[model samples]
Target: MHGKRVLLIVSGGIAAYKSLELIRLLTQAGCGVRCVLTEGGAQFVTPLSLQALSGEPVHTTLWSLTDESEMGHIALSRSADLVVVCPASADILARMAQGLASDIATTLLLATDTPVLVAPAMNVRMWQHAATRANMATLRDRGIHVVGPDDGIMACNEFGPGRLAEPPVILATIASLLAREPVPQDLAGRHALVTAGPTHEPIDPVRYIANRSSGRQGYAIAAALSARGAGVTLVSGPVSLPAPPGVALVPVETASDMLAACEAALPADIAVLAAAVGDWRVTHPGTAKLKKRPGQPAAPLSLTVNPDILASLSAPGPRRPALVIGFAAETEDLLANAADKRRRKGCDWIVANDVSLPGDGSPGVMGGDRNQVHLVTADGTEAWPSLDKREVADRLAARIAAHLAPHSLIRNSP
Candidate 1:
C-alpha cells in the first residue's frame, strides 16, 4: 500500500474542504498525494493549500509552464497509478461523462488510461435527477470505481445525500482499489450469462411501462467477469449503456425478448439474472393512441403474467448453466423473500437486496449506489455489509468463478 501514487481531483463543491483532510490521511498512509483543482473548485480550496498538505506542487492549470516542459497534458494525466476524484461535484461528473475537457481537472481525467475513483458531492435533488443518475451508470459501466456521497447533513444543511464520504473512508477505499487481485484465467474456457436493465411492458405503440433500473449492477458484473477471462453473454434490456469489452451483447426491449436472447445463449458455466423482469405485461396494447372521450374514459387495460426467467432456466432445463443465480429486490422480510425466491426459482444462489429508501450513494445497487444485500442459498444465508456496488460485484463474481473449482465446490453444490 505504501508508495502507491494517487492523483486527487478536487472539484468545486461545498465538500472541497474535505479534500484537505483526505490528503493528510493518504500521506500518513505512506502514499504519495498529487492534487489538481478545477477552476470552480478553487473557490473553496487553493492550490497552495493542497500543495502544502500534499508535500508536492499541485497541478492547478491545464497549461503550466514548468510541468509541461517535456511532455504535455497526456503524459501528465497518465503519470499517476490512479486518479481519485473526491467531492466530485455534479458539474464535474457531467463534464467527465460528456468527455468535455475545458479545464485542468477534466483534461487529466479524459487523457488518463488509469482507473478513476469518484466520491460524489452535490444537492440531494441534483444527485437524484435522472440525468445525473444516467451519467453515474455510464461511468460504472466503464469500470470506474465510486466511493461515496454518504447519507447525512450536507453543507447546505439539508439532511440527505450529496455528502462526500469522510477522509478515512476515502483513504481506505483508495487502498482497496490498489489491492485489486482479479480472479485468474481458470475460467478461461467457461462462459457466463448475465441479464440487466428494466423490462418494458408495452402499453401502446408509443408508450410502455418500465422500472427505475439503471442496469448498473448487471453491467458491472459483466465487466468483472470479462476481466477474469470468461466468455460473457450480456442480455440487456432497453438501457443507454455501452457494452463492456469482450462481451457478447444482445440488446432487447421486453422480458420476452430478453428470455429469447438468454435461451439462445445457453449452456453457460454461470447465469446471473440481474434484470428486473416485469411480473405483468399489457394483455393487448392499443394499435393507436386511444384519445380521451367524455362519456367513456380510457378503458382499463388488461394485464397478463410474464414468464419467470430464473425458474424456467433452472428447472433442469436444456440450457441450465452450472450455477443459476437470481436477485431478489424486497422491501420487507428480505432474507425470507430471497430464500423463498431461491427455492422456488431453483437457482443455486439468490442475492437479496433491500430497495426501500435509496441507499447512501455507493454504486451498482439500484436508484442509489451503496448496497446492503444477503447472499442466500439452501445451505443458509449470510448478510453482506453495506458496500459500494463495485465491491459487491467484484466479490460476488469471484465467488461465482470459484464455484467452478471442482474440489472446493463440488461436494458443497446445492
Candidate 2:
C-alpha cells in the first residue's frame, strides 16, 4: 500500500471512531490518508482528532475559499488512488446510490473517478430495510466495493447485522484494493454454485418453519467468488439480503426448491452448500391456513425428511463439482461434528463453526455476522480467528483459489 493515496470519507455514526484506527494503520503501511468528515460525522468525531491522527487538513465543507484555492473538491476527489467511505451511514449510502451531491462527501464521491469502497454501519432494522438493500445493490451494480457492516450489538441496544467491520478487516481490504498487481481473476471460466440463507418449510399458507440464517455469509462468499472472475450462481433461500454483484440469483423457499435450484446450476467447478436447510417438512402440507376452534385440541403435525442437498451434490457423479464444500453449524464438539459431517456428506472440505455462543450478546450464528470457523479437511483442522463474515468469505475464497491452482491439484482427485 506504500505511496497509495486514500480519500477517506467519514460519515456520521458511532463507528466514526474506528476511522482513527484505520488512518493509523494506513499511515503505518506507508500510505497517505486524507479525511473528509461529514456534518453528521462531526457530531461523533471531531476534526481536530482526525487531523491530529492524519497529520493533514480534514476537509469538512464544500465552499472553503482558501482550501478550494489550494485543493479544490474536484482536485481532491481525483488526488487519491481510491476513495473509501467508512462508517457509511444509511443517509450517505442512499445518497451515493442516488447520485445525490447534497454535501461535500457525496460531492467528492460523485466527482471521483477512482475506485470506491464502502464500510457500512447502521441499526439492524435500517440495514435490513428494503430501501437500504436496494441502494446497496445499486452501488454494487455500479462496481463499488463494499467491505462490511458486520452483525453485532449496536449502540441502540439491539443486536443484529449492522455494526461496522473491525479496523483490521477494513485495513486488509484497503491493502488488497491498493495492491500493485490487479486482484487475481483465478476463477475465470469456472462456474461456482453457492447456497445461502435458511430454507423455509411451509406447514400451511401462513405458517412455516425456518432457521435464523441471514444469508450474509453465503452472499459474501458469492460476491468474493465473483470478484475472482467466476461465473457464480447463488441459490438463495428466503433472505432479505441484496443480490451480490456479478452473480446469478435463484431465490427459493422450501428445501426441495433449493435442491432443485442447485441441481439446475450444476456442472459447476465448485459447490458450496451454506444454507441451513430445514431437516423436515410437513408430511402433508395444508392448502389453507390451519385454524383452531375454541376449546378444540391442537392439530398434530407430522414431518418427513427433506432431501440432503449436500450429500447429493457430493455423490460420485459426472455432474458433481470438482470441489464440494459443506458448512456445519454445530453447537457442541464443533470440530468433531464437522469432521464427521464432512465424511458423511463426502465433501472435500467442511467449514465448521460453534454457533452455541452468542455474538455481541446476540442469540446465535443463525443471524450474526462475525464467525469463528475451523477448516476441516482430510489432512487436519485449521482454526481461523473470529472475523467479520466478509473477511471470512475473502479468506475462504483465497484458499479455494490456491486449492484450484493447477500445481496444487496433482495431490487430489476431482
Give TM-scores for every candidate, taking all chains together and pairing residue i with residue i. Answer: 0.86, 0.75
Clashing pairs in 2: 151-161
Clashes of each: 4, 1
Q: How many Å off is the CA of 118 in candidate 2? A: 6.8
Q: Weakest 10 consecutive residues, lDDT, candidate 1?
A: 405-414
TM-score for candidate 1, residues paired by index: 0.86
Q: Which stretches of candidate 1 lie over 4 Å from their true place?
A: 14-18, 53-55, 65-70, 122-134, 150-160, 356-366, 407-414
Over the stretch 1-414, how does candidate 1's per-residue lDDT look in tens digits? 698899999999878999999999888989998888888889999999999999998777867887777646677688778899988999989989999989888887898999899999998899889889878867876778887778798767788777888889998889988887745765666788999989999898888988878777788888887777778999999887888888888999888898899888877778899999999899999999767788987779899999889988898955578888899988788888888888888899999888874444543336565677889988898888877666678878888877777733221111
